[model samples]
Target: MSPFAKLLLVYDGSAEAQAALERCAQLSLALSAQVDVISVVDAESANAHCAGLLSDLAFHRLEELARSTLDHAVRQLTGDGIVASGYVSFGRLNDVVLRHTQAFNPDLVVVGHRAQARRSRWWGSRSAHHELTERLGGTTIVTVTLPGT
Candidate 1:
């Protein structure tokens, strides 16, 4: 049996995300695994006053974009003959991914992360990738890094 029967991919349409998608495709083919792709829309409002109608509109637009991004990723994987499905989620990156992890119970979680310079990291702050990996705990994670990153 394949070590990883199910895989979850976190995609955001960035170059790094594209790299992750490609890695997932490779893994799926090698392991004969099913993949679930997810794209998250940051629905948190930046301004407290931007509520009611404005917030709703902003959220809707974000959701639409997320859906489009996810659709494209899924299409690419399916076209490659991989069994893949995708959906859009709303919330912080780590939170959304963690929730999906719980529901999907994937054997492996794949994510794309761009490396940052040591000076670029702020004091007492962690990158989103770090937070996600930590939150996932025991789940095996495969991080795909972009070239020249």
Candidate 2:
């Protein structure tokens, strides 16, 4: 029941997300556990602009972008001798992450936390991680600490 066992990381195509993935990979190697990296497609947001008719081409594009992001992360992890898998799903970031969390039953959830000095966050919203922490009990939530404040 170590804290490092079974880690789940919420990934976006952001530098912070990459940092979180790296941290998760390090921990996965330390614990000899597999890390699941998830990237949300966010169909709901796209629906708002597309009149709920997100074109197949556009959807496919989204999927490709997500796969590229996750694949890169998986490669980094695997290259480092860490067990890893990637998943891309649709819906709100938190919802998709929670759904996968339920399925994976990870001992810990790793997410990139925004630094106040940073300009913007790409994970949709920062509060989602806070909400996740409140909703999930006994499951530890880790926020990747950036290099600087």
Which window of ten consecutive residues has the lowest lDDT sum in model 1? 45-54
Q: Output the number of the lDDT-best candidate.
A: 1
Clash pairs for candidate 2: none
Error at 46, model 1, angstroms: 5.4
Residue-level lDDT tens digits of model 2 in 65-91 = 989988888888889987788898888
The whole-model C-alpha lDDT of candidate 2 against the native structure comes to: 0.82
Q: Between which residue pairs do clashes occur in model 1?
A: none
Alpha carbon lDDT of each predicted model? 0.89, 0.82
Q: CA shift at 106, candidate 1, in angstroms?
A: 0.5
Candidate 1: tens digits of C-alpha lDDT, residues 1-149: 89899999999999999999999999999999999999988766423336534566776787888999999999999999999999888778889989999998999999998877776675555767788778989998999999877
